[model samples]
Target: MPDSKLRLPPEAVKKQHSLVWRIILYFALSSITLSVIVGMVLATWNYHRQTEAFQSRLDYIEAGYTESLGSSLWFYDETQIHTQVKGIMNLEDISYVRVTDNLNLDIETGTRPHHQDIKTIELVYKNKPLGNLQVAFDRQAVLTEASQTAIMMIIAQLASLLLLTSLLVFVVHRLITSRIRDMALEVNERIDSNSSEALSIPESAVHDEIDILIHAFNTLSEKMNNELKQKTRAQQQLKQVNSELEDRVEERTQSLQTTIDELNHALKALNKTQGKLIEAEKLSALGGMVAGISHEINTPLGLCITIHSYIDDHYQQLKSGFDSGQITKQDFSDFVAIMDESLGIMDKNLQRAAHLIKSFKQVSEDQTGEHIRDFSVKDYLNEILETLSPKFKKTRHQVHIDCSEHMRMSTYPGAISQVMTNLLMNSLIHGFENKEQGNINILIAEEKGNAVIRYSDDGKGLNEEAKQKIFDPFYTTKRGQGGTGLGMHLVYNIVNQRLQGDITIEKDCGCEGACFRLIIPKKLDVSDS
Candidate 1:
């Protein structure tokens, strides 16, 4: 039946949120409170105004009655008094009128019967007219007036309160909360997106603490991004610096290695010079020995030469004699057989001496030739073995060259020549030193598009300790008597560091003797030199 009895939604009962709604709420509440206070004050004031006004009207009537009574001995008839009271009742602004004879104590109304308060007033007036006016006004009009004034006061107080509350709410929202909400929403949006861009707050919104917060956040985000970029750039710069440092270290190491190589080369030249001196001394000694031995052999050689000459001179004579029957058949045959045997021995000695000199001369000459050519590898390398044939023969070492024919390429012929020469000498002097018959196999073939060269020996397989240092310069298993200890070191340098080819010691069951596998490019680039 009433709006107050109806249920309200949760939101309606709950606190308001928007600035405008809160402003409405604030005004409504303030207006209600002020109206309540004003209603109470007006209620009190209206009650007092009615009380004083009614009291004054009662006094004015009592005074008029007292004056009109005069000095009569109180003998007014009840009928006459009632008529005079009826006259007073007709006056304007008066609600009721009554008269009570002061002496007889009799009350009369203006002809109409009334309720019993009149009897009580008659007793009081009969004793004395010196009491209160014995009449009560209707009072309905005063009650109505008070009620209407209270209602109007409440409405006016409420209206003024509402206006004042609204003004305050508007001022607070504009000055503070509106700007705060704007800034808060901006920050929340940026945080949700994880963006680095500065928030653009309104210039009007920029005020007090909220403005400070916006600027600080923008600066913080900008600083963080800049710092991260700077860190990334610094890391890149660090990597570049490290790379440059590494390159510098490598260059320094290369320069140092070049110096060491130059020194080694100088040492090799010195060794060669010493070898040449030794050879020259040996040659001089050999010449002296040859001269001295020639004198000792001169008589015999002359005898042999003279005898052979005589034989040559007489061979036809002897044959003619035999034919002419100047000698017997048995004697001629015996002389011919003995002379032939002596001449053959003399011819073999002269040929053996010549061959010895040629073999030594070849070895010396080979060491001197460093020229490179693109000769057939098989032919070029085989010739090297052929030249070393005498040395192999003395040591009784077997050698093989398995390079394919027609497999030609441009390379340093001198390097390969020296490499092969040294390897053979190494095997002869050290590999087969204790063995009666040593076997060395060299294979050069193409495998999987790369030139493959392998070296292996069956004499005494390389010792494990020696194998490890086999490529180190001046490291050798061979003693000075038979080796210069640079063979494998030189081979390693030529095959790997110089030729840009890879070389590895092949896996052996230890039965492959010392096998080395070299994977060489088919076309050797000479730029490494």
Candidate 2:
């Protein structure tokens, strides 16, 4: 499917323009723009130079012919003046010249054009003004010469530009563009034929980008071809398996009825066994709670008993001294002191015993019954931990709880207690199995009207497989050990079904131990209950 998508469409290939033509068009436009600019600058410079040369000719005529013409005019020689005027006209760009004496005699040569520049010079000989000489320059003729030169220069530039552009186009097309077109055509052909043939590298003196592209394309083609071959083999194997399955189906039809009966019987037995195991797990949890509470209450009760004995013995001594009339003020004072100290000790131990019993009773009822009620999250968690203190007190493991004292929830405390019990047990049995000491932290907060409980342990963290199947029933890492594997499974059921909540393991928590997050509604709906 992916390979078919990778094949280029025919319309796309047809619509693609030739790379060589695009390059040529761009190169030609740039060349023409540059040539036009340079030609304008050169033509302007040539025009200015021609104008300067014309000015130089006028200067020469003023210096060389002015004195001679002035002498001829002073001598009143008309022929000599005419010859000088004619000679001046023969100079470049001088179309007309005239010389006149003071007596109004004039000699002139050449015809003046309409567009001409006239220069007037004084004719002087021996410090005497003879006449005024006027020279006319043809502005049109000078302009014409500059125009001709500019035209020739532009023509040569254009010719060179055309030749250079043609050469570049030819070389670029031959070296790069032609090879690319060939590769495209070959690729299109292979796509049409559904062939997996690798592209052929073109002949080149040096390896370049084009060669690299060919190598990469060939590698991709070979990989795709291998994949196609594997797919073909897989399809053939699937057909063979289908044929064999048909034969097996016919043979299995003979015992189909027997298998159905046996399966039904086995399913019933399995259900019965599962029910018993679940019941046993619950009983086991309750039994452990009882043992823990009993062990906790023993210390306070024993202390109270010893204190009671000491108080009674002291009272007897006081009574004996008073009855014999041998009790003095010091003895009475000592007796009062003994009585006060003993009573205080006894009262403290009795209070301790009462508190332990109260915690045990509350946790026990919550674990046994499915009653929903309002309770403080912090207080209830402490009570649950108190009941499980025996399991923790035997080891150096510590449990810490972080929750607001005022935070409350209206849900099944029994389900919550059971979930917590199973989690702590998992941490003890699996997470901190071989560790001498570990820390268990429980953080409770409210988010969006839901009680968010984050529980983590500072023990060996769970592996990938354990994290994946940790909630699956009968999926225990310790198969032969005293691991029921139903502890976490029961926790999953209680949180999801009983409490109508979600529980998930935090995989990327960066903790050295396992971490689990539970989110349950602070108040369960009637329907949920």
Error of 1 at 332 (Å): 10
- Over the stretch 1-529, how does candidate 1's per-residue lDDT look in tens digits? 1123433344432422355566667668777877777777787788678767656755665565544432122554445555555655654334566554434444534333345422223223344543222455545556677778888988887767767766877776776556655555566667668877787875544367667777787899899889889999999999999999999999999999999999999999998976575445334333433443445345456666776776776577677887888877776786678678767766765554454445434434444454444567787666566455545656667787887798875656555655666666666666676788867888898876567788878756677787778887667665665455555766777677655677677656354466778776666666655
What is candidate 2's lDDT per residue for 76-115, written digit by digit as tens?
7778877777788788777888787778787767775553
**Clashes per prediction?**
1, 0
Tell me, by TM-score, which candidate is best: 2
Tell me model 2's lDDT, rounded to 2 decimals.
0.83
Q: What is the lDDT of residue 77 in candidate 1?
A: 48
lDDT to native, each model? 0.63, 0.83
Error of 2 at 347 (Å): 1.4
